[model samples]
Target: MNDELRLKIEEYLGGIMSTSEATLFEQEMARNSELKEEVILQKQINHHLRDDKLNAEIPENEYTRRIRTYVKSDEAAHIKQVLKGVEKDYKERVKKPRRKNLMVAAILIGALLLSGIGYWYTSQATPQELYASYYSTNDLPSVIQRGDKDSKLAKGAVAFQENNFELALNYFSEYIESTSELDPFVYIYIGVINMEQGNIASANMALDNAIDSNTLDSSRGLWFKALTYLKAGDTENAGLFLKKLVESTTNFNYSKAKDLLEKL
Candidate 1:
């Protein structure tokens, strides 16, 4: 590769490439296996170069200067010799070698524990994915009073029970417009319907209304609101609600909330 292309690759690996340039480069990589391999190799080298803990006993500037000088030089054997000398010097200078060994051991142990924890975390589904796994219309409040005989509210409840979310939502909307005393459960139903349809923001707004109305068990509203945030991958907000649910013994799903909080 030309010097300009080499420098561009370096810049890209360093994350300093402009958005448009990065987009173009990614498009190029899609078509070029050799370019992709070169980029991956550069990234691996960059990772080692960025690790400050690599040669902790060496003075930062002196070690950096040695590395840069060796890399820039054309003499490959000289580079190996210099690196060996650097390592030997660090080992010789550490008079308390046993203490250094203990410190290194401690670091290694901590790193292993962290790596295990990270693997466990990443191996599990994300909050959004977990929400999908746990979610069910059965969790929603059952239609207790199907309203006046053959009423829109009754029809909406039937549709909701039948899993026809859109039709249920439409019926509920018409009922809300027709009635003066709006049932808070209607808002809860609407919110849940929106959530099932993946309309996160709308679900949240309706759940908020349910909470503010102070009708229908507001704890259920809070629980569903938290689930809405969880489904949308807003774990911060979801955690807040989950914490609240855990604190409230009266919430129906307190145990489930506690379980979800532990995952977060």
Candidate 2:
């Protein structure tokens, strides 16, 4: 089957198809024996993939070997060529007595293996661990202060800079309470702190508030909100926000957003 049909089958297997799409697909499957057979094969693959007993039957190294054994001839040839290039580069570096190049090549290979393994492992990671990998507070603004350094917002900025998240959140909350409409960055900081505190839903709400503001850094709110979803392991919402950022031509993170959307 074509890639579109194959993806539809996979989505059906994953139970992600919309009701209308599923109904149409089911009707199509009734009339197409090949589609029905492919669906069955996909279901079997999914079953084995998720079966602890089937997975535990073979050690990881044996599974790796099995996967290698099935690599197409052309793909194998391409991989061999890539490895040969690395080998040749390493030998040349050794001949020149430049150890750094050899180290770089070894690192390159290790990174390839790690990235492939990491992708699979990341998909199965808990929300907390994923958050640890992706969540980081943005740098503090550098503009001249409009308020006194002793002000609550200023104290919050200082606390945030020092990584004292709770103190920062409290100070920002005080400042927000005293102001008619606080800076968008205040809500962003509050959201980040809430996320670090394991209050994901609260963090998202704070970020939504930030995004609805009229501040110059408004687009950054969307970026951080998408990141919040990513930390929560909600790829669908993360992709949605990232896609939005990519579509916003004036956004500073547009290119990065596009790259991240592709990865998701």
Candidate 3:
């Protein structure tokens, strides 16, 4: 847990560094999902595990009550007899239809409950997957909208990263004109390149599009939008965008948004 590496990753995420640096950081991040998840979780825990944050400030009696809350209900202690082998041992007519129905119903109920819980757990995935799922789920307007233009946006991102802002701007503009299905992130990066090159109007437009463009889900996409707005000095919209991201797993953005909110 070197502070230097931590800061380096954060800076890379903020788009202030070179692509080679970011690629290295991303390679490390992608080496293991658990390691990357742990990295984010540590950042979150460091922010929230503060003296004044939660447990430390609670009264002894309240804390004791919180502990008691985990005690199981009476139903958890109560045991139910399971008819495990009854179904297999009997033919349809050998057992009463009523008995068969009850067993089948119970098994289905258990399965449904288990499936529901599993689905809920899956839905609570990390934000990056959330964004990816969001992108993939939309079907991307299947028309291709225009031929070969999508690749130009990708090229634009690379050019922008290389600081060829004018060339990046042209590619982005061409890509933008070709299709409406562009990933919102491209708009952010394209806008940022424009911003850095002092094309305030286009920069504002690009970031605004990133913020306003339709997407399948609201992961930290709102965070990107908020950052773009902030960079554009549109604090009003930025604050509003950040407000929607408060309860998400996007704690890095949540804390950053809190800072922006305070300043506003």
Q: What lDDT score belongs to each candidate, Candidate 1 first?
A: 0.76, 0.73, 0.55
TM per candidate comes to 0.51, 0.48, 0.35
Clashes of 2: 0
Among all windows of ten consecutive residues in candidate 1, which has the lowest summed lDDT? Answer: 114-123
- Give candidate 1 misplaced runs (Cα > 4 Å): 1-123, 144-146
Cα displacement (angstroms), candidate 2, residue 85, comes to 59
- TM-score of candidate 3 against the unseen true structure: 0.35
lDDT of 1 by residue, 118-213 (tens): 435542679878788667666776555655747887788889888898888889899889988857678888998888787987998788777767
> Where is the poorest 10-residue window by lDDT in model 2?
135-144
Q: Candidate 3 lDDT (Cα, whole model)?
A: 0.55
Instruction: Report the alpha-carbon TM-score of model 2 versus the true structure.
Output: 0.48
Shift of residue 235 alpha carbon in model 2, Å: 0.9
Off by over 4 Å in 2: 1-136, 139-146
* Deviation in Å, model 3, residue 189 alpha carbon: 1.9
What C-alpha RMSD separates each model from the true structure?
A: 20.8, 20.6, 28.4
